[model samples]
Target: MLRQSFTEQGKRVLKIEQQALIELEQFIDQHFDHACQLMFNCVGRIIVIGMGKSGHIGNKIAATLASTGSPAFFVHPGEASHGDLGMITRDDVVMCISNSGETNEVLSIIPVLKRIGAKMISLTGNPDSTMAKLADVHVCIKVSKEACPLGLAPTASTTATLVMGDAMAVALLEARGFTADDFALSHPGGSLGKRLLLCLRDVMHSDDATPIIDQTQSIKDALIEMSAKGLGMTAVVNQQRQLVGLFTDGDLRRILEQRVDIHSTPISQVMTRSCTTADADMLAAEALNIMEVKRINGLIIVDKHNTPIGALNMQDLLKAGVL
Candidate 1:
């Protein structure tokens, strides 16, 4: 019975918040468009300010904007009253968030911000409140009710505020034509960045580490090279060091099934002639796509002249965090 009650309470809270988001959809009108245009045209960074819970949400919104090509940062309203207000400039745009549109700490900085000649955009539940009425633009984030059963804690209102903030950031992102490569620059340490920026040359085994064998070598010799390089495959090259074929673990299995003599059979007779390959300059993500489509476990990197220069397996990409 206790478990059932807890589950019911959770569902009720989600239902209320979901409805609040639906209502927020109606507020994305001309005013939202104007706010995005103001942010897009700002010469300096977008300075976001709020108090308490709104401050926490503002911080995330600022981070989102900064990562998506709009330069932005968050400022505590209380700090602005002391001396941080100097951070504002005539070229900057200030965005203030307050649930009631009357947070004392946030409201107190309005006159000083205006004095600095910064354009203001207010996000609040009440458009009639002092902060909303004074700002150059107001975005209404009004929710019909709190998800809190007692109607005291800010559950539904905060959810609505966060959704509205995401809408604003994404709108600005599309307006600026932000691309994945641009986003990768801001998140260089993450997996997405590695996938977008790392090329085969950055992770492939080159020089002596590449498993290269003469096409005339016996299958036993190819196995030795594969084992020494630990790549589960060996590139078969001609007398001039030009890649002619590839011998992999899959090929070894098929040859063994046919009872071929490993010690006497030349690799040229058993190696795959039309193996999939990638250039050293190709992106690791692109190589991964080729590997997936061709259903192969290893890939060889070749020079412009079709000479085998490097090699890599799925494990290499996994170790480099590009997989």
Candidate 2:
């Protein structure tokens, strides 16, 4: 009986929050457009101010905005009054977040922000509230009801605010032509950055470390080169150093099944004539796609002239955090 009650209550909360979001969609009107325009046009940073729970959401919104090509940062409402308002510049935009639009701390610093000539954008649950009346633009984030049974806690309202912030950030991102590479610039320390910014030239084994052998060389010589480089593969090149084919451990296994002599057989005879190759300038993630599509574990990177320049395999990508 207790488990059923818990399940029912959990479902009820979700339904209420879902309804709140549906109604919240209507609030994305001209005011939202005006706010985005203000942010897009501003030459200075976006300073977000909120109190309590709203502050937490504002911080996340600030981060999202900053990462998406809009320069932004969060500041506590109380701290703004304590001289943090100095960060506000004439060209800046201040995004004030308060569900009731009546937070004392947030309201107290408005006149100073106005004196600084910074634009004001108020996100509040009450469109007719004091903060909304004083701001240059007002965005309503009101919800029909809080998910809390007693209707006291800020539940559905906070969710609505968060979604509204995301909408603004994404809208501005599109307006500014923000791209994946631009996003990666701000997030350069994680796996996502590596996938976007890492190139084959940065991770591939090059020069003496690259396994390259003449096509006329014996299969045993190819095996020695492959082992020495530990790339599981060797590039078969002609007299001009132009890549002609690839010799890999997989080819060796296939040849052994046919009772081919590794010591005497020419590598050109047993090498993979049709092989996948990549350019040194290609992104590591792009290389990963090629490897996956071709179902090959190793790749040879060549120059524009088709000369072998580097070699890499799945393991190298894994170690370089490209995988």
Candidate 3:
């Protein structure tokens, strides 16, 4: 009995919410475009206000907008009545949310918001409600029905409101020509930021830590340098310091199985003539992709003349948190 009840309830909720989303599309009218254009033309930041469930969605929308190149912040309607109103400026745009457009706390501040000459955008279910009527631009998130079986919870209404907020943010994001680099600036502490900002030179081995051997050196000499550097590989460079080939522990083992004379055979004979390399200024994440695709563990960083300037291995990428 319990399982059947759950199945029925889940289906009902999904059906209601799906209908709500479909109804929301028609509400994206000229007012929605006006709201985006107002935000795009704002000389200052965006102040988002809401109460209850709408408040939660409003906070997230503000965060998304701020991270995507729109300067935005959320102020609770309750707090705005106290002293948060000081945070709103005449040059800013105010985005207010209330499902019924009649929440007392939100409605109480509409007059002051207008008095300050701030542009107002409303997200509500009722176009004729007081808050909507007072707004400069009203975006209707009206739904056909509530997802709650008892019609008390805010399931469908919240979903429509949230999707509308997302639509607005994305429209503004594209209209402003916001790029990934702009997003990285806002999320500097995240993995995306690290991938774009960190360069090979910032994470590569330097000084004696880099394993380098002359092309004329014997396989035994290359092995000694690789061991001392502890990178499992050595860059084979010419007398001019230009990288000519690479020798790894794997290469050494293959040559040894063939009974090649390690002490007398030149490293250039067994070394890979063509290996993947990166520039010193290349992003570490790009270097990681090259290494992953080539199935190689190390990369030599070279200058314009192909001279070995730096070197990094998979372990270095891991240590730098690029893995």
Candidate 4:
């Protein structure tokens, strides 16, 4: 029996896979560039097909491509031979993944794909194998060795394939100038999407919910308004209802320490005249950045006319999942 500890064996596997990735770098030649350009120029979606373990990696690659603006989907090669090939179109690009470059299930459908007139890019460990020779562009993902001690499992080769897929997806994303907002649109349910798409207008406490008080109002009146709205602050506006200042719980503490009379003192006299404010149309993420930089817990959203339209604090952002 092997005497190596579990930790030692784990480290051995990692080292083997690491070396495989290092060797995989040399295979990113002109063939890889041609494959990317083919996918980039395709008028329709990029279709990725592989069998077994390769198919799993292909699915992830297709998803990465789709979210990064390349628009791709995966079709199992076995399924492809079973009427799923109808999904492929002449205007699309088909990517085939086969470690040996000789997957029987994968090879069985190449002739049909060729007949469909779709461009093909082959990702395989063997550059001279049948699938590579049949492909329009062949990308070699040859690895030095398998991470499995017996050299039977698909660890290193699969890792190399997945990393190569990531490289291609990112390269294509850069070529397309895919922005974070574009990526967010494709992932609207994810945290990144919420952070990118959520605007102040979408999360701010607006209308009657906005805490506002006249500049001439007493500090006690501002406190009442803040307590009513529960935003920890109140916007101080002039007779025109245009924002002039802000008063918050911090100001109340400062007043308390000074022993000032809230009922007699006007809010404008104690309010923060030069305060951090955000535009109503600004993204909530941007607002969060501003609040963080200013070390404040609340924000006031104003329009082009400098009129206070909305207000929010950290709690509002947390509730909206912008935190």
Candidate 5:
């Protein structure tokens, strides 16, 4: 019975929060556009300030803005009062977040921020609150009711504020033409960064490490080259070093079944002539896609002139963190 009651209460909370978000959709009006424009046109960083629970949400909002192409950082309102206020500059914009817009710690620094000549934006539940009145632009994050049964906790309000922050970040992101490449630059240690930034040239084995063999070479010689390089495959090239075919472990199995003599049979007779290939400049993620769709484990990197320059396999991608 207790578990059932707890589950019902949790469901009630989620339902209330969901309705709050649905109502928030109506609030994305001219004011929201004005806030986005303010952030998009700013020449300097955005300084986000808040207190207590609002401070935690503000921190996340600042991080989202910074990672999405907008220069931003969070500043505790209490810390700002005690000398950290120097971080604010005339060219910067200040975003103040307070549920009631009457947080003493935040209101106390308003004068100093004004003196610094920073533009102010406010996110509050009350549109007529003091912070809203003082700000250059105001965004309302009001919720119809608190998700907490007691009606005191900040559950719904905090969720609304977070959604509003995301709305603003994405708006500015699109306005600035922020591409995946640009986002990857800011997140070099993340998976998306590796997918977008790493190319075949960055992970492929080139030069002597590339298993290249003359197309006229016997299957025995091709196997020797493949074993020496350990790429499970060898690129069959012409006398002029032009890629003609590929011989892999799978090819070896088929030839063995056909009873071909490895010492006398030329590799070109058994190698795959229409092997999948990638350019050196192609993204590693794109190469992975090709390998997956073609159901092949190995891929050869070719130059513009169709010369075999490098080679990589699924194992190579795993080592490079592209998998």
Candidate 6:
């Protein structure tokens, strides 16, 4: 059946890659440590180079290293032969990737790169190959078999190479003490950036924008403030400027059905006595969680005395990239 054939192929790929990973573990030696040390000690950026499929993997490794505080970038080996070799300097480190360890385009530029006095680290399947043998440090990435049944396509070999690249990037990441804040700085346009960079005070409404009422105020006054602010809610405070209760549109609708006189009824009798509030210094992402669990659309920002300092609704969170 077609399903059986597809399943068998999937299993074969996993098996081949799993074995490749096991083989890669044995390939890690003193040279791997030296490569890490060379990269760590370098004052300048790391320039990664490769050809064909190796180039794609090299590009990803360079991006990972750069984002994790390693200061790296990728360059095509073919382009290096054309004059891009000027990008490398004596203070820099070059990481080269090649399956055969004898890529013509890469090997052709080695002499010029070396003459520039740049340190070299080579990743290859053949430790005896010229590229690996000539480099200052060599990392072996040999695989026993290709995931392709034809044994011609670059399957398990490429996966092994990418995994080894990830291992090197992650090891350096831990050694450098890279934190989430560091990652956020590198990805300022991402969700993690918004969560880290945005604060409660940044998205909250201040001054007259917040709906507030005195504890002795009638329910009608509270409802008028809530409607004018359009936050669907208002905070009730005492004479000491401390929060007392909250009044929402939901409470108004329920009380309306009872035919209660809003003008005569005190807000304290109908308002939610125990209300949730957030601090101005908290992250906006944390505010979103409180809104989700409390199933409310608005929150009042309060000080230590529980006095309403600011306010925000779900729309505020949306505008601030918290949602």
What value does the lDDT take at residue 188 in candidate 6?
Answer: 85
How many angstroms is residue 219 displaced in model 1 relative to the true structure, after the best TM-score fit?
0.8
User: How close to the true structure is residue 284 of candidate 1, measured as C-alpha lDDT?
Assistant: 94
Tens digits of per-residue lDDT, candidate 2, 235-270, equal 999999999999888888999999998899999999
Instruction: Please give the RMSD to the true structure for each candidate, in Å.
Output: 1.1, 1.3, 1.8, 1.8, 1.5, 2.7
In terms of TM-score, which candidate is strongest?
1
Clash-forming residue pairs, model 6: none
**With candidate 1 superimposed using the best TM-score fit, by how many Å does residue 134's alpha carbon deviate from the native?**
0.9
* Candidate 4 lDDT: 0.93
Give all candidates' CA lDDT scores.
0.94, 0.94, 0.91, 0.93, 0.95, 0.90
Winner of 1 and 5 under TM-score: 1
Q: How do the residues 197-289 of candidate 1 rate in per-residue lDDT, one tens digit apiece?
A: 999999999999999999999999999999999999999999999999999999999999999999999999999999988999998999999
**TM-scores for all predictions:** 0.97, 0.97, 0.94, 0.96, 0.95, 0.87
lDDT of 6 by residue, 10-49 (tens): 9989998998999899877788889999998989989999
Which window of ten consecutive residues has the lowest lDDT sum in model 5? Answer: 33-42
Model 3 TM-score, all chains together: 0.94
Candidate 1 contains a number of clashing pairs equal to 0
Q: Sorted by lDDT, highest first, which candidate order results?
A: 5, 1, 2, 4, 3, 6
- lDDT for residue 198 in candidate 4, whole number 0-100: 94
Expressed as tens digits, the lDDT of each residue in 1-323 for candidate 5 is: 99999999999999999999998998799989988888888898999999999999999999999999999999998889889999999989999999999999999999998999999999999999999999999999999999988999899999999999999999999999999999999999988899889999999999999999999989999999999999999999998899999999999999899999999999989999999989999999999999999999999999989999999999999988889
Clashing pairs in 5: none
* Number of clashing pairs per prediction, in order: 0, 0, 0, 0, 0, 0
Task: Flag regions of model 1 displaced more than 4 Å.
Answer: none
